[model samples]
Target: MTHVQDGGPAYWRVAIVEDHRLQRLRTEELVGRQPGLRVVRSCETLDELMAWMAGGSPQSLPHVVVLDLVVDRGRDADPAVVERLVRSGMRVLVLSAMASVPLVRAMIRAGVTGFVGKRDTEEDIVAALWAVLRRRQWITPELASVMAGDAQRPRLSDQEERALVLYASGLTLDAVAVALGVKRDTVKKYLERVKTKYADVGRPVRTKIDLNREAIRDGLMTASTVENDRR
Candidate 1:
C-alpha cells in the first residue's frame, strides 16, 4: 500500500464507475483537479471497468476505484464483481447516495476500503480516496453515527467474536473452524449463538452479510483485522 509518509507516487491513479454521464464527468473533473490524484479511466458500468482492467497492463491498474453502489440506471453493482476487484488488489472507495447501515455494512464485508456519501463535497470524496490508498477505512460521519446507534446491539463472547470476524472476512465456515482449531459444527454453533444474541436484542442477523455489519459495529472487524486475516 502507498503512504504519504513514505514519499508515495507523484499521483495516485484512479478509476471511476458511475452510470450517469454528467455525474461521471463531474467526478472525473473533480478528481483531476486534486493535487496528487489522477483519473486513469471513467467508466459507465462495472462490466466496462472489468474489461478495462483485463485489457490493461498491471502497472496501468488504478490505485483506487471510486464506485457507485447503484449503477446501471438504479441497479445495484454486483457484490461478486466488487469482490473480484478487491481480491485482485484494487482498493475500492464507494461513492453512493445510500447511507443506510445495512448497505454500508454489506459493502465493507465485500471488501470496500472506504465509503463517501454522494451528498458529501468533492473534498470529502477526495479525502476518502486518500484514506483508501493509505490502507485505511473511512466512512461518512452520518453513517458512523447510525452504526453507533445500534440500540439493540449485543455483546459477544470471545469465541463468538472470533467466529464472526473469521467468517465475515470472507472465510468459509470450514476454514474458520480450522483456524480456530475447532470442529465445523462448533464454529456453526458459535455463530448461531451470536445470531441469537442479536435477535434477543431485537437486531436480527439473518445472513452472513448482516453478521458482518454487526461485527463491524461491535468493533470486531476493521481494516487491520481483515489484513491480518489475509496474511
Candidate 2:
C-alpha cells in the first residue's frame, strides 16, 4: 500500500499499462514530463509489463502503476494482477474510460489506490497520481457518488458479469454459451455464481425475471430494456 520513496531514486518511477496505442504513448509523455516523476515503461498490456519486470533490473521496480481497468473491449483485467502489484509494494492507480458499477467495485475491492475517468482533465489525472503516491485514495466526484450509492452492490467477476448481462438481455443458456464460447453447463455455473453473490449481498435473484430486474437496477442493462421478454 505504501510506495518506498527514500533510497529509491531522485524521482518516482511510474509504469503505464494501457490498451490503446495512442493513449499509452500520450500518457508516457505526460508522466515523463512531470517534475520528480519518470515513466520507466509504457506497456500495452499487464502481461507485457510483467514480462519487463521479470527481465530484472534494480530499476525495474515501479513505485506506482497506472492501468486501464478493462482491456480488449469490455474484458476486465484480472483482479489478481492488481493484488500482485499491490503486494509487490506498488501503488495502483486505475485509468479507464470507465465501466460498470460491479466491475469497478471489483477492482476497488482488489486494493487499487485510486480511479480516474478518461474524460477527466489532464490536471486532475496528474493530481490523482500525486494523491496516490501520497498514500491517499483519489476518485472523480461522479465515480465516488456512483460507488457510494451502490456501496452495497456485489462485486461480480468478469464471467459472472457477462453471464448476467447476456442472460438478462433475453439470451437462453445455449445462446449464452455460444456467445461466450463455453458449454451450456459452464454458462449455467456462471449464472449460479452471480446469483450466489447477489444473494450474499441481500439481493436474492431466484428467477430469470428477478435476474433481469437486478441487472437493470445495477446498470448492466441498457435503458431500452425496460422489460425482458416474458417468453
Candidate 3:
C-alpha cells in the first residue's frame, strides 16, 4: 500500500498515550492541525488508556493509537495493550523517543504497523502517520540507519550475549538456565536486563532471542554477534 502523505481529505481518528503532559499535548496539537487526522483522547497512563477504551463508547474509540513505549518509568508497556487495540480494530502507530532496533522489531512482530522516532523531523512524523493510515509500515530513515549501523557493531558481555541468543532461540527460561549452568532466576535476570535496555528506550521488551532476531534483521545483533560475544 502507498504511504499516507498525499494530503488527501480523509480523516483518521487518533488517540495518544503519553505520560508527559507537554509532549502529549504537543503531539495532540500536531495531529489536530493535520488535515486528515483528529485526536479523540489523550492519555497519560496505561491504566487510563485501558479504562477509557473499556468504558468509552465504540463511536469514541480511535481508529489509530499513537502509543509510546514508556507510559510510566517503572511500568513497562504491555504487549497486550497493542493486541487489544488491534483486536478492537484500531491501528497503532508508535511514536516515541525510545526507538531501538530490537524494540521496533518486537513492536512490528507484535503487529504495530508504524514506528517514528521522536528524533525524526516533523515531516518524518507526518509521513509516518500517513504511512500507517494507508496500511504501510514506516520507519524513519535516520532511525533505520542507526539500527543498521548498530547491528554491525555492539558492546555486550559474552554471557549477556549468550543469554540473548539462547532466549531468542526459543529456549524456555528454565532450559536456558540449565544449559548455561546458572540458576533459572539468574538466567531470567540476565534476560530481563537485556529487555530493560530497550525498555529504557520506551519500547516493549521481548525474549532475548526475539531481541536478537530484531537486531539481526536490523543488522545490529547477529547469530555470529552472539556467538563471538560468548567468547
lDDT of each: 0.78, 0.79, 0.68
lDDT tens digits by residue: candidate 3, 64-104: 88888865554645665675666556778888876445655
lDDT of 1 by residue, 1-231 (tens): 233433778678899999988999999999888777889999888788888888899878898899887765655677668867777778899898864456565566566758888899888888888888897878787766665565666655445766787898778999988766699999999999989999999889988888877777666566565666677
- Show how many residue pairs clash in every candidate, following the order shown: 0, 0, 6
Q: Which pairs clash (backbone N, Cα, C closer than 3 Å) in model 3? A: 4-130, 98-201, 151-219, 151-220, 167-209, 168-209
Q: What are the models' TM-scores?
A: 0.67, 0.61, 0.59
Collision count of model 1: 0
> Residue 148 CA error for candidate 1 (Å)?
4.5
What's the CA error at residue 139 for candidate 1, in Å? 0.5
The deviation in Å at residue 212 for candidate 2 is 22
Q: List the candidate numbers ranked by lDDT, top first.
A: 2, 1, 3
Alpha-carbon error at 24 in model 3, in Å? 1.0
Top candidate on TM-score is 1
Residue 59 shift from truth in candidate 2, angstroms: 2.8
TM-score of 3: 0.59
